[model samples]
Target: MNPEDLQKLVTMTMPYGKHQGRLLADLPGNYLNWFAREGFPNGELGKLLALMHEIDHNGLSDLLKPLRGRGR
Candidate 1:
């Protein structure tokens, strides 16, 4: 994914849900999987969630560690 998207994963908070206010990068794989099964929300949040799902699915979540706190 692009740098801004990666950065957002670590900085942007989930706007709503049980995980509201949680970092997108820190969301559990199971939660992302739930999205995969249930379908992600619309717009930018959905895009980020889908990206995170792929990262978590492939066990590459750590790739985002260095980008934390640098999001726009």
Candidate 2:
């Protein structure tokens, strides 16, 4: 979607839940799917989760590779 959103995937940590502390980009597909089915959280976290879900769902996760270590 936007550059900031994509960057947040790599740089931001999940603020809560089983995946807390994990990079949003690295969240498991199944986990993302659960959010897809159950509805993602509200606001920016939800948006990013939804975006990551799409990326993971469509197998476009590789696109995130180039941006991954950039945040580290």
Candidate 3:
């Protein structure tokens, strides 16, 4: 995905949960891993987080670093 897409994925608020309103990028890796093992939810957000989990696991979070600085 492009940087803008990555930024949106990171900054988007969680629609439901105790951590609702928190950014997707800020969610703990363990939680993401749990979703990975259990199966991700349906919808675009779910797909995005699943992709984020893979990217983060692969040490490519830096790919979004530029967007982070752009304040998106």
Best model number under lDDT: 2
Candidate 1 lDDT, tens digit per residue, 1-72?
688888888988899889999999999999999999999999999999999999999989889878875635
**What's the count of clashing pairs in each model shown?**
0, 0, 0
RMSD of each: 1.2, 1.0, 2.0
The lDDT of each candidate is: 0.91, 0.93, 0.76
Model 2 alpha-carbon drift over 4 Å, by segment? none
Candidate rank order under TM-score: 2, 1, 3
Candidate 3's TM-score reads 0.78
Give the C-alpha lDDT of model 2. 0.93
Candidate 1 yields a Cα-based lDDT of: 0.91
The residue-level lDDT of candidate 3 at 57 comes to: 88
Candidate 1 — which pairs collide? none
Give residue 19's error in model 1 in angstroms.
Answer: 0.7
Q: Which candidate order results from sorting by lDDT in descending order?
A: 2, 1, 3
Per-residue accuracy of model 2 over 48-72 as CA lDDT, tens digit each: 9999999999999998888877856
Tens digit per residue, CA lDDT, model 3, 33-72: 8889999899878887798898778877777656653554
